[model samples]
Target: MQSIERPIIALDFPDASTTRHFLAKFGPDAHLFVKIGMELFYNAGPDIVREVRAAGHDVFLDLKLHDIPHTVEMGMRSIARLGVAMTTTHISGGSEMLQAARAGLDAGNNTRPLLLGITQLTSTSEAQMHSEQHIAGSLAADVVHRAQLAAAAGCDGVVCSALEATDILTATDKEFLRITPGIRPANAATGDQVRVVTPAQARKLHSSGIVVGRPITQSSNPVAAYTAIKQAWNLKG
Candidate 1:
């Protein structure tokens, strides 16, 4: 297996204190991607991104912006000012929104954040997808379609489930990163995530990275959890 030096551990916590506590436990050597979701972002704002970066960890602002072209562009421009390493816009938001976000990133003239398109969420299931969301076609087919839209819109990658990674790799070029979430190691509780895979399996399927939250964050010993996962990905090497 290929060795990954630093796996991006998404800090999907509710508050700053919880985030800080986890970071302290993990220590500075841990390669992390601090995911600032709605709750934390609403509370901490752009300052959270700055603080995470100040601590030498890359920040992935997971706002999952899904609005009109102009609004998304303006929002992306504002987010870009925060100096995050990556940001997400929903592929379901359409090509225009994605394009606008990309343009906003270009306008920043700063270290460009890797713009990823959010495909099917890890929490979604086929029944919910068809009945509730009213989306036609199979899940894998939909993911591929959205990924295509993301690529056309100049997104650097897509946030997809590991199950869809191989298909995405086949459909797109190697440079188009596939950031898969819903990663649960063997024997770990599945929790709310429906589409799950092991770290090694995800890597083998050609996923560029995997976003693991509760499995690491909710563990009794967060460091041990992270290390175990890192080892699973062969990052410990």
Candidate 2:
């Protein structure tokens, strides 16, 4: 949390080939923090993680693991062996599950990756959460609650919306990380994201890290786009 770089790019490609090609565009010596979420990981497996790491970037394997305690613990063991820098499990899975996830990381017999719990997805709006999930609290409150639970359970950090970063940072110790997704540049469209913030805004909220997707991947010059966004984050962070 003290010295983390901003703008962890989501490598949301369809397959291993496309992911490889995308990484190639960044050229050699482009060592940024990258996210290998469900899509690419499911399609490409551990090799994608290895490929990315071999190129000198840090990998955040975003599986968002959720299941029985034993099940999740074993799953985390496997994910940990991949040597990723971070991973996610749903905070809704409860404290037992979160503790088990951390145990899994310890059992790996390798360098443990940071375990970040998912507070809420950026795609889910307040109305959707109320109507579909039957949650009554405001989004920010729920996110803070989830983050607090994660901290109590020994998690290193949590993945939350930048909107909740201010409250979460205030609520928890500065060492606890708040890795925010749903980040868009000031000029970028919201796309499918409902809870969104710009890199500068997230920085202002004291976000530990920001995740950017299409804005960089879809750009003609992804490297340039990523550089600009990272620069924006630097201004406030």
**Estimated TM-score per prediction?**
0.93, 0.97
> Candidate 1: how large is its RMSD?
2.3
For residue 74, what is the lDDT in candidate 1?
A: 90
For model 1, state the Cα shift of residue 68 in Å: 0.7
* Tens-place lDDT digits, model 2, residues 41-151: 898889989988998999999999999999999999998888999999999999999999999999996799999999999999999989999999898998999999999
Best by TM-score: 2
lDDT of 1 by residue, 1-237 (tens): 122234577777777887888899867866576677788888877787888888888887899999999999999898888888789999988998999999998788578888999999999998889999899889999999899899999999999998998899889888898888888889889988899999888878778887778888888997898788878876422
Each candidate's lDDT (Cα)? 0.84, 0.91
Top candidate on lDDT is 2
lDDT of 1: 0.84
lDDT value for model 2: 0.91
Superposed on all Cα atoms, the candidates' RMSDs to the truth, in angstroms, are 2.3, 1.1
Q: How many pairs of residues collide in model 1?
A: 0
Summing lDDT over every window of 10 consecutive residues in candidate 2, give the lowest-scoring window.
Answer: 1-10
Give the range where candidate 1 is weakest over 10 consecutive residues by summed lDDT: 1-10
Q: What is the TM-score of candidate 1?
A: 0.93
